[model samples]
Target: MKFRYLVAFVSLFHAFSSWASDSFIVKDIRVEGIQRTEAGTVFSYLPVKVGDTLDEEKATEAIKALYATGFFKDVKLKSENGVLIVEVDERPAIAQISINGAKEFEKDKLLEGLKQAGISESRIFSRSLLDRAEQELKRQYISRGKYAVKITTTTTPLERNRVAINFDINEGRTARIKKVSFVGNEKFKDSELRGILVLRKPDLLSWFTKNDQYSKQKLSADLETLRSYYLDRGYLEFNIESTQVSITPDLRDIYITINITEGAQYTVSDIKVAGEPLLPEEEIRKLILLKSGQVFARQKLTESVKLITDRLGDDGYAFANVNAAPELDHENRQAAFTFFIDPGRRVYIRRINITGNDRTRDEVIRREFRQMEGAWHSTKNINISKQRVDRLFFFNSVNVETPAVPNKTDQVDVNVKVEERPTGSIMFGAGYSDRQGIILNGSISQNNIFGTGNFFSLDVNTGAINKTYAASFTNPYFTVNGVSLGFDVYKRDLDTRPLSRVGTFKTETVGAGVRLGIPIAENDIVSLGLAAENTVLGVFADSPQRNKDFVTEFGKSTNNFPLTLSWARDRRDSAIWTTSGTTHRLFGEVSVPGGDLDYYKISYHQKWFYPITDNLTLMLNGEFGYGDGYTGRSLPFFKNFFAGGNNSVRGYDLNSLGPRDDRNLSLGGSKRIVGNIEVLFPVPFMKDDRSLRLSAFLDGGTVFARNIDFNLMRYSAGIALTWVSPMGPLKVSIAEPLNDQPVDRLQAFQFMFGQQF
Candidate 1:
């Protein structure tokens, strides 16, 4: 009430002043109430001057302009006896700014952004600037999963001219998903909701993908989707009663609770059409799956809407909207729903324009797009193309818009914009294993070769068994067709005795290979390859006397090399980091002069990812591989199959799988398989390009001499932690065998670093 009265009093004062100050001032002008603003500055803005007429309108104009500068709390202009008075209350200026409770971000950087927005040291500060700074800072934090935070700004008057500003930030706590529970859901178990919810608790294998990090916004969106699920079925009155998030004492862990009132589920008891039914009611009703007596289901209703839209589309009614309105019978707990569809008009695509990819070639996008120029645009095709672009892994974001074409009625043009990301990398790394000890790896790889989005790679390493030199290149687009060509040359040394990790080495392989890849569809691919190899496997001096008898039996000066054929299909989001995918590879070799040469190997791997929170996740990776017709004799000795090390099983020594070696040491070969379950969490300390992640894993696998005989194959399990660092990824594991083996040098425990693969 006082504020209202002040407004009225100010208005009356202005009216009276305007009427009274109409007289003229014909003498020297004088300035009063001067402070931070110079007297000359006021005189420069005033329209009326000495010896000139002074009017109320001119004074009012001067006062308004000063206030518009946004540097004053109050402004007044008075003229008495030819003396002018211009007084103003100056806003406090910022003397300095300090920040606290920040760990991931630097104070200087945040201050710099604030300064750019006109809130800086030695400058006046306002609540507006503080609010804006808070939002900007939060956006920066939210992009990296710091969703919950608080910012408080304090201002203290300083001597002479400014106020000290402090942005006291209570970053609160990082929200990590601890548990997600669903109540009153008897039809589907909590496990089902866990699969549906995008958020999940962090797992030991979280390094591969971030599945943890709770975001209220994201959770709210998911809940809406769940509600839609219920409404679509026949529960017209379904509602989410409430959602609660409880934090632990430390505030680091959070539990999510969702309460839902499912209400009474209604089945479609009857179907009918009213008012302007273009098609037969029975025909349209037949398209819906809500049988007259079936139980209500939100999933089915949603699908029914889709069916109606697609049915309308077949009749060239692309701009049609089909909505299902369900009229419930509360007495019977049933619903008779109606699809109130409104088909406005039929429209066609006019043109398709692509933008935002200044660095990438336009043809690259055009090739992947299913919708063409001057063609009927299918909604399904548009979404599929979006998925295709997202799967490229070379773009940060891709946006597609279909703007109505001007000067062309009933037609639209599609515009696509792409933001490119760095697609090539060169990594130099070193890894250690119980078998290899420490190994040096130098590699240069390019997924988008020369900005064309092809692939080329060269890798060199000096490690146990895998000591090799390799070079390869690939072209995803060959002559504008979805064809790829790849070639590689490599030299590797293989040693069968794993116990003597420092083995009596074998000098065997000198080889080359070629591959060709062709795309079958947007979601499918096929690859075929051929390779020729020459190897002379050698058994070293430090071996059991059985080796001498074996050599005499084979009577080998050397064995002729074999030719290999390989085929594979990889339908995964990313080869290095796949959230969901299926990868299959089959490689075989046939020897020419090496006694009925034949060897075949098959490997299959899958990964399912769930993001429990922005910073934590659960990752389950399952893998299985087997080698058939692998006599180890049909191929060159050096070409024999083997497995071990960090990427294989940690508890056992590398390649110590199949039969015993020359010195009675286990050498892994033949049928082999493994599995991994891991949880990932963000690192405690580290600000990085991609927030560093840590994880723990439990992996198990085994090997067999021939066909899988579970009893003969050994099983091992272990716990390993991995760190995805800016510099590189680091991993360490401690493993043990299911069945104890005294001679097993690595069975007690194992530790390794670098990549799991």
Candidate 2:
């Protein structure tokens, strides 16, 4: 019996030990070795709970779950007295990151990039993440053509299981494109192709353009441009075989080679329109730019499709589609095309939504919108709405979209969004001229005061020769039909004692006026104004006889009533950065019977801009002014016209081109003529920046005391720069007198800085 009991005891003890080795019934859970993480946090990630059978698979899964959290570098699980204990060796957190020897990029920008790569401070550290950060840095440098950049990283262990990372960089020279060549081309010269490319060898403009730098993105874009050039010129079968970019061993120079096949040019043999005709077939055919016997241009074909789709869109087909299908005759080198039109549905605008206008009232934007709710969606109206709002100059950008309404097949919503800009400004500027001396000026103006779309301004200008104080207010929408009302009060003082221009005299005037503007057409306005003024003239012995006679006839103090009539037509695409269109203004001011002086002044001004290319514009501006006395009275010399200034003909002294007195001093003129032809383009290498402009201009103008003489006109040619800086619009010109007379006072360099109203 003693031997049997011993054998049973040994077998039972072995079985109990085997069960504990394979699995366990957990009674509790414990987490250890975590520094910043809480025990409860580890328990939440634990796949096994207490009182559950914890086996080998469950323990492995639990360790994987904790490890995947990235909070720990190692995890181990064990069971003691039916309690599962999770032990984790937490990874070190990043305490700080520093970069050294970085000159090409901002430190904060580099830190932002590293943060995107999961290597920022306070984040868990990992060797793989560090490698990723290094690669990101390399990518940035490579994009900038810095192919020889070297980056070395160091990580130091810190207290509390933390790490500080440092990146030492050696940014080398930028790899420039040394050569670009073409292969397998017969029709076009290599020079022509290279000229069309954005990438080029170093040139005078390379310092600003950086076009000499070799970049994959730039190369790819060049390839696309080259392809487009071919396609637009009837090379429909052109194909690029291969492009090879080779860098020198030192990575400081790059060579690009392109192989292409320019197949035979094709002509359009025939054209037809297919599918449902939303409009008359003849009308649709008229919209097609490509005709039989013309070259097959992809650009023209694309434009034809767009025209058709736009026409359909105007007819309420908001999602119109037009695709041009081409049939080729390889032997004849001719192509026939068909436009398939798909007018999906007639859609109406269910609602008009406005957004991003925090300061402006909803009605302000709504009033500018031509597209109305509950009406058929019209692309033309929507575009007009966007243009109207943009022309206000109150917003940086205006975007419009017609998104289809959910669960509705024939309805869409117009979403008009705007980005408001600073519409109010306090301007302070100073300018100096030989005649005007030092001119100091300031103004406070708001184009959209209190978001009401009204304009208010107070202006003050003081100079050695002139002083003016004025305040004006305009309510653009005083009436619902776009009639505008404006009021202004002003005081002007002029002292010509120290100037050699005109007669030496002093004058003080005060005036108040009210004006009404009536919108006569979509782009035309008629303005009528009435003002009353009182003038006091100080005519001394040294004054000109002409001025003394006028003072004697009209007395030292006199009151005058003036009536003003003006008409304006503005069709420019934009008031600022105008690239195309024309503007015309016809103005006349007449002193009525109640005034001490009876005179009239009439002027006509016109401006036209033609876009020669995407980046080039041709502008033509002209102004003609004529003034004379009525009722046999003489015209006031002070009201006469003056030319030869920065605003008129450059390369001459300010207000210096006119009839001269016997003393050779300039006498004001009763008539003036000014004309300018300017070729405007973006500043070299700064095409993307819209605030700067450069123009080559030719100017011709002259002022006449009585009769006009074109032969007496002065001419100048020069280059001008316009920069819309934070302070104001700054203009500088360097001109050469083309046809200056002996009496002309030449001024080659002129600049003016003033804020826009």
Candidate 3:
């Protein structure tokens, strides 16, 4: 193709040179040989116009300009009898594009990539462009570790000077890492350094993890990790010299080698604070993590600077600057550091600007902000505001920035940017359990309705033993002062044959409730609610003694009115995967005097999380509940609390841990106590991912009807996997009971899919 273009250019140049001495003027221009390109486009590229003097040089210039446009393959200029003729061969347009044999990537994604490479339909086609596009596709495959990928392109000519381009892609097996070797490391072994990296040699779990796949991005990130590891281990002058990635001849295996310079380790000899002390020097020193005689760590130094700056920011120094200057002592292998603080002018927020929220209302995001507009800037408040917005789960990302106002030294603007995510979910799931038989459940929920930050859900569950239908809605911001209003209505039908020894009878309940939440503090909420429910119990000849007595005393139908009061304080950093925080909730529900059943139930739940390491967290959760009849009525049997489930004791059957009836059916208790201690860690080979977690837990709980016996608690130990999958949140556990009785019900494996916990 290049040779043909070259010949055409040479021929046109030679033809123009022959007429160099002859010049023409006052002539009309004519264009020919253009099939798809408009005549106007040809004329626009022609340097010489009609009625303008045209010489051999002008003719040559016009031909060259036309060819440079990339719209034509050949260009010729001719002059006869004072008339200039411009002739060109337009490039063919791409009519269609087809890709085949591409499995690793979606068809639409490949098409979009081709479009970005100027190889889409209805565009001018050239052989050079096509070659470049093929190379680009190959690069994309290689980035995904598909080194054996082959791309073949063919063009079929069609009518009207258009061609159909097809790309035949053969995406072969991905290259796996065979070995990773490090060089120039004396203090740390190769295995130690490799453990710090995400990329690794193929292992038993390679099929599930894909960690052995060679990815350029992952390699780059691993290099950064290696650097950080050294810097945090007192190697202040560490540097990665070079890295080499090698693939086998067949492109199925890969080997990586990284070279580094492990500089001399240093210890901190002294630490000092310098510059203007806007606050007490002792207070600033308390924030420093560095100490004398300790090994110098770059991470700790950086953290110390950040803490000092944030401390100043809390006192209205929004633009404070803090720097750590190190003085190295080569002979002694010691380093002295001085932290310099610059408390810039105390700034006030001039305005708060919110953007990138197209679906959500501005007020919905603004209500989460703690830093008010026109108030003194506080970094603490700004960070809290960002976290609060994140907790809403309405946005994919929330970012806050402070930009100084023009012409104002002491004023700045707070810019909160959020990227909204889809907050509506529709889910359906089916499960089969030995106790419940076949169960089908579905739900439609929206956390953000019409950009109002309201939550609405419709839930339905149907099983052989149980059936329930419910709808609920909550307005998180019912008022400007952060009050919340919510309501719920539900109908449930329970066949007691499976779970209760009360004969083959059924119980039905219909209920409705309204609740209000008042915000007492930033993290505290007090709730009040009232509900009315009517219960109907069916009796049979084989009914149990307790059920027969209840039906005979209260009749087949009974009505009750319940009032609820609750308070909660939540300080979790994240709602989905909390690593650090504490949450406490206490609630009480009491049936009023005029109801058929008068009882009060009180419960307390407390949870705390402590970060054990960067990748591990320790969590403690405890729940206690107690209920009894008030005035003269006994506690309703249906209101009893049951322990033993995935959310309680994993090794036991659902709601099966308590007193048992004559037929060995679980009878729930009026007192409940459950506690769990878990260590949450990142799943192996997926440490960088936040959507998946693995936990080892110890759970103990028991329920009592009359007296609480702490020694009667059932203990279980288990390993759990939680994944925030695209379908929904999934939880799976395998557990073993430590203390199991002869008649105790045990379930070793429990799992729930397409549901949120």
Cα error of candidate 3 at position 14, Å: 2.2
Tens-digit per-residue lDDT, 24-70, candidate 1: 77476665555576777767766667887767666666666765665
Q: Give the winner by lDDT: 1 or 3.
A: 3
User: How accurate locally, in lDDT, is each candidate?
Assistant: 0.66, 0.88, 0.87
Residue pairs in candidate 3 whose N, alpha carbon or C atoms collide under 3 angstroms: none
**For residues 186-250, what per-residue lDDT tens digits would candidate 3 score against the true structure?**
99999999998989988888777778998888999999999989988888889999999999999
lDDT of 3: 0.87
Better of 1 and 2 by TM-score: 2
Query: How much is 263 displaced in model 2, in angstroms?
Result: 0.6
- Among all candidates shown, the one with the greatest lDDT: 2
- The local distance difference test score of model 1 is 0.66
| TM of each candidate vs. truth | 0.72, 0.93, 0.85
